[model samples]
Target: MTEIEFQKNFSQLQYHLYTSPLPHVSNLHPHQKTIHAFFMLDHLREELQRKNESTLKTVNAKDFNLPEELHVYHSLYPLDQRQEKSIKIFGYPSWVYKSVCSVDGRVYCLRRIEGFRLTNEIAMSTIENWRRIRHANIVSIREAFTTKAFGDHSLVFVYDYHPLSQTLFDKHFSSSSLQANNHPQSGGTGVVVPETVLWSYITQLASAIKTIHSSGLAARMIEPTKILSTNKNRIRINCCGIMDMLTFDGGKNIHHFQQEDLIHFGQLIISLACNSLSSVLNLPKSIDYISRHYSPDFKNVILYLLNKPTPTKSVDKVIAMIGPRILHEINSVHHYNDFLESELSQELENGRLVRLLCKFGFINERPEFDMDPSWSETGDRYLIKLFRDYVFHQVDENGYPVVDMAHVLMCLNKLDAGVDERIMLVSRDEQSCLIVSYKEIKNCIDSAFRDLSRRK
Candidate 1:
């Protein structure tokens, strides 16, 4: 029989045998065991063949086409007006065509191949996993299509388009001549700003990283460039690290290599924090810090072994040099202050002080303030009036509002307490500030006055 016919017949036979229940076997002679092993090999080969055939059929380029009735949602530019540009997939052996989606007008990255050796079931499982994961930080998978084009099967994974630009690394390392101070443009319409927008981008990225960690998955490849800031304060994290490295023959011992991802994440955080600090301090930009700071711990060790000088390259060192510690301390204190403020706000929202403070013009009325009711029902109008009264009339013997801790706490307490109670504080300085509501102040003062009267 020809090779093709032999393969087909062998596949058919193995499929039947493997599907059948295993025969009970006693201790067999070497020859019998060899025969059994041969059958096992045949079964495995047939299974592999089936898998390859399934993959080839699915990836056939002819099977895929743009779906009709494509709905446009959140396109950066006019879908009908934007020109479609094709990008060649460099370094990949597969023929992939990437174009902007006319329906959504987002960049649609497509991988089209004549054949693949991955099974349809495997592909389906991967897609299913992708669908289950949803986060503001993660790029949403809009749709996937498998269709035939000119007798060739094709598969496409559709993701929300994120405009690509010079990654943080590219921007930092590329030749100075290519560096222009113009607002860096990305996406189709070039409406997004990169420089003035990085703070929100960094925050969104941290939130996304937090989400990923909560999902029991480590984002292995977290670098500045891999993070894209989408419209509406959302961020898309590219290069997810949850892939099976072994499946792609990308590495050995996939489980052990996960530590590399942890180091990378730490490096990313350090870089983001340092950059933010530098910008805040109005310091000159420097790439040396980022590069030296992000060098893998193992790489630093290797350099030491090779008798090469290595910088103090660790996240801890970078954090120490930068103002992260001071920021951390301040944030912790601020968070505690916010907690106290929230408590005061809840009390005010419950109308505990409505009767006591209304005489002082500190009534609860809905105001044109941005404070959310979900955050605090003490109406913005009430807070604003209370703040103004406290600023003007409330002062201690030394001319300081009695309520002062942090901004949030100070605002809430002064609002809940009448301006008359504010006279107890010595000064606005944190050390002399007393963060207490009107009720607490009244009880303390009333008790003091009664004690004085009895002594008299």
Candidate 2:
């Protein structure tokens, strides 16, 4: 068989395979799965379009007292609702803003440390080392520089922007009790995060820390507020390399810092488990809570990280303990990949149909072609006109419009595939008719389009 014929048969087979009812599986209708997949893709398209539009939208710079330019970045908009003095983490009152990079026209998250003086010029060089560190769970830092545009001496660090992302603290701890109270999984005790989800977080954090330590650097900040949830259960370590720049001492104690990273990692997890940042203060109660709620492996992982600093205690040890959990996370990732590929296939089909429709819109009902008034009314072009009417301008016996979407889709699909199925095309006057196959109409469209393009 020809390629077109083979494709047509294969498409039919695939449709049947997806839609066919199976007695062994369950009692489901033939078209249920197909319709669900179609609508799921439709919703996904809408979500993606909204996100893209939101990212591309620019706010009025005049509305706020914003800087016109800051080292190749412009159009700065404050991400925080209120510019409260938050000196807990960075020691300096920091502000986050979304700005467009003038050089590349891409948006980046600019973290400005307000009134931070550059005591040592070597501190700025630490960002270069961070620029080399890239991992899936780490929000890669672009660059850092000092600017006086904000009416003060400010140190700015550029990082990638994830639209509509929330901090781990904001999503979980800030309103943990409310979410847990409303959640069906939580039996109303509040702050009941699932053990599996905690495992996922543990594995992802370990992976990121391993990458950081391997690059001869350390993730000095690993708090809930410093991590962002870009999507559901998907997180990335935010504000990396800022501490190194802020606390730049001439003598470097990489080992001590790395050990502090482990301790902080353990405390973050404990705080998340106990549903309070103060959980680290009372280790006995927190350990008892973890013991009662979580598995032994999880408890052991926490215990290992919370232990006193030693020569052998490292992120590698944590990884070795959670080996099977890491495997489970990988398996989940593979399943998610499969689901995305299936959704992507549906989108590919949509893109093809859109192109086909665009081609029809370009060729059909031309007012004039090659300066010939009767060009579209004569020869093969006339057949295309009749085919358009057959697809869209259909009427019933009572002269009422028949708005059948299924018929329109079927005709378009057949035309795109160039199938051998023939149909009768009637003129506007109803005095003449011509029989032709989709394959012939397809050739007519190509020939007419090519003929039009060769002009001038």
Candidate 3:
């Protein structure tokens, strides 16, 4: 993805993580929650600015305190927004980040915790235990250190950045006309998911869970949104490790909760086939449509997983039931394509980028129709507006985003990075005119948003 597109997607991801309704948080009034959310956002922006502006010097072992400092760069995006809310990792509510390592110019993901009164011994021991875990499907915490650099008591654990993603939620909920309006089981005029694909996804995920189970760990959240799809028909579970911290609430080990994980996984499979979870568990008969499309064997396995009374089966057995792929090989490959255009979609797409860029003074076309993208303020703004207006849809004031990141990323990937067009910028504050190229403006927009957002 282009830098601009990645920032957009990152913004959307933060929106999802932040807007997740905390209905259980009854103590705070609605306005208070909104205020708190914005406050948390400010904290995130400030921390990001500090990290971005600070000089990232190399680590010195003799004089270096890994806890105090280890030159971290390009981690301007703060994963934590609402500090008042306890976000969990493996059951521990901690902050997480996508960071660039100054030492080796490699990117990494880190989980953060305000280590208030936390001891290094406990932190190191936890990190060591996590490093011992070896699972292809599960993300493991590799390195850790304590730092008061940002504030009081901050413990950070770093992990590899696995960006392979197309959340299970989007795979089913995407605006692709075929997937949206054509699921046969969902009464759409389309065939149900190929048995091969369904079985493949389940088999791969089952193996991953099996490994975690063997290690005596349960992926507490196994729903569609929490799972990520990668190359080779693989799906990795995300947002783990903090469930126990949340569920246990520092109380005690809860073994039966593991069964809850199994139950959630079964629901995921059903949702995948059915397309929606409307009256699923209450009426076991709701699953009849699945049987109609899939084979009796497939239906039976799904029913067994969904049926609680029947003895729970292991992942190995689940795979055994759907033994080797004998038929229906999928030779067709999938690619991200969102280029198709509709008036509403185009308007929505343009509106967001237009208004957003206009706020930054990048738009100078007077907001009229029949305008060429290059006529805009800069190549960056011109290209951004052109792409947005032509490709994506406009969202309502309070509406959630309808355009998917895959679509944005796909369109961005097709762009000619070498193309450069110049545009003039007359700053509103200074009225000073400056000649700049599209590429330069596009790169500066992220920093502009960061600086402007803080002022707001």
Best candidate (score: lDDT): 2
User: Stretches of candidate 3 above 4 Å error?
Assistant: 1-74, 77-96, 111-127, 143-157, 174-191, 246-254, 277-285, 309-312, 325-456
CA deviation > 4 Å runs, candidate 2: 1-43, 176-191, 397-400
Please, what are the lDDT tens digits per residue for candidate 1 over residues 298-361? Answer: 2232222223223433223322333333354446557756865654553444353343344334
lDDT of 3: 0.53
Question: Residue 198 error for model 3, in Å?
Answer: 1.1
Ranking by TM-score: 2, 3, 1
Our model 1 lands, by Cα RMSD against the true structure, at 28.9
Residue ranges of candidate 1 with Cα displaced over 4 Å: 1-115, 143-154, 162-178, 181-203, 218-225, 231-234, 239-258, 266-456
On lDDT, the stronger of 2 and 3 is 2
Better of 1 and 3 by lDDT: 3
